[model samples]
Target: MKKITVLIVLASFFSCTSTKIIVDRPIVFNDEREALTLEYLENRYGLVQNTPTIVPKMIVLHWTVIPTFEKSFEAFDNPTLPNWRPEIKDISGLNVSSQFMIDRDGTIYRLLPETTMARHVIGLNHCAIGIENVGGTEKLPLTKAQLKSNIWLVRYLKDKYDIDYLIGHYEYTLFENHPLWLERDDGYRTKKTDPGQYFMQKVRDAVSDLNFKPLPNED
Candidate 1:
């Protein structure tokens, strides 16, 4: 009877610990967005899936340089790429997005499906999931609550997917030679420093037991 009681208690504990994600679909999802996403997969990454979806192998953490959740959501909410980024216009007009967004208070919001492709990271988007936190600027730094939230989200994803790596946005370039890094245009890469190294280290340390591969060595 004691053993059964212990098992019940453990189950209850786990149930309480699981993270709850709120769903907030992007304002636009249509044939245009679908086509642009597919074009990006094929033209940029050389991946031609029958559908606009990916089998995630990595999770990339980022920070919205944009300070507020409303603005960040508004930026990614548009399906078409804004006119400001003319450099990537030739590739596709699809605006960059992520699978999930976490607010300053550590509330997790799902902007897109985990399997659906969102143009967050450059090279590895074909098989990587992106998590964008609300802020990364000096005035609105990321918080401990956000850190804990990211740790929980990473663990949750690792449990459900065959996730092999966890990397910061700045580390995306390190995967240039990796088989998963498939961007066709050599000049298409963008420099990034997001969610910061210190924040990523804290997350990595928390999930060290997951045994994900270390970031590829810098050349």
Candidate 2:
């Protein structure tokens, strides 16, 4: 139960600014995970670095699709992919993870350090910070509380970093050949629909004042 507290100034739904909290419920990022991260960075992004770190330029949001917070947490807590996820296991044993995760009740949890490189997105893991939500299946759509929390996180990260983009998981493919896309394998892409359009749009609208750069299709 190691924890670190962060106090962020958030824009309330009614346009007033208030302080909000982000809890640090860390997952296992031991020596083994760090080694995998470094190897993945070098092999995937052509970055041969001694330490696995990323200068975040974007924020990508995702939904767990696995109902409970504990289950979703467990999924990303490991350093290697589990046996059940055979489709992506061979791609590199590094498990998928995000820097932040939100529970259905709008509880924001930090799964990893914001600056660390996480294997959440396809091509932009080298420069994007990820935020995952607890639920987004047809059985359990993302909740309003989650939307508000996401909006808050987007603003917080934008203020803390030089973030140039805010995107949903599905929009990741749009950056395929753009300057930031760094995946060497052209065929290593996968279709995604986590944290759907409506949810993304709501979060976008709430933080529209931030003026994040347009997605590839928007221009």
Candidate 3:
């Protein structure tokens, strides 16, 4: 029975590799305290805490769209929020960054600590693990090795954290009606297609045994 259970888990893990977020490196935190301000956390992630806040809920996936992992890392390494992301920066001192980045070859780079919110998604950062992939072009598609790494990372995160939902960046807007999408009302929105749909489904299926929360307004 134990061997059967292991086989079942392995099979599920393989089936869901397509949409996993691979963390190729160790996670690092920003020394700048401004990045951890409550105002910033509430603004970037819709996290409201009259007290110390710690809630681990979802995992959000993305693609750098940028060509290389180093460039992606450099963009995230900054302590100051980039002007391009000012709308969000204004809301929270927290600059935009992800906890993890996966390269074209599937090498994962940990940009920030999972516990410290590194502004990645507009309304879900407080409770989501944002995993950024290196590139999103047909010429250099996300690879098999990367997919395997993603599975490993997802399994680890699911076991370690109370992660409930897993979604691609493109699906964020869909969550606008959910409780998590409570960012300031600048009417800010971005249409994104990263880490692809087919990729995501595989990941979802792989971790299906974990019994994720029902998506808002599901049949």
C-alpha lDDT values of all predictions: 0.84, 0.89, 0.66
Residue-level lDDT of model 1, residues 1-219, one tens digit each, is 111111111111133655355545454668889988998888887777778999999999999988888899888888899997787777778898999889899877777878999999888988999999998999989999899789888888888899999999999999988988898888887788997999999999988988998778665
Better of 1 and 3 by TM-score: 1
Minimal lDDT window, size 10, model 1: 2-11
Cα deviation of 39, candidate 2, in Å: 0.5
Highest lDDT scorer: 2
What candidate 2 gets wrong by more than 4 Å, as runs, is: 1-15, 217-219
lDDT head-to-head 1 vs 3, winner: 1
How do the predictions measure up, each by TM-score? 0.89, 0.94, 0.75
Of the two candidates 2 and 3, the one with more favorable lDDT, higher being better, is: 2
All-Cα superposition RMSD per candidate: 7.3, 2.0, 7.5
lDDT of 1 at 72: 92
- 1-219: candidate 3 lDDT, tens digit per residue: 111111112323544533433343433343464436466665555556653234668888877777887777777766666788655665655556777777767565666566656567766666778888787788877777667666667777787888878788877776777877666664777667878987877777767777887676543
lDDT of 2: 0.89
Q: Pick the candidate with the highest TM-score.
A: 2
Q: Per-residue CA lDDT of candidate 2, range 76-192, in tens?
A: 999998999887777789888999999999999999999988999988999999999998999899998999889888988888899999999999989987999999998888889
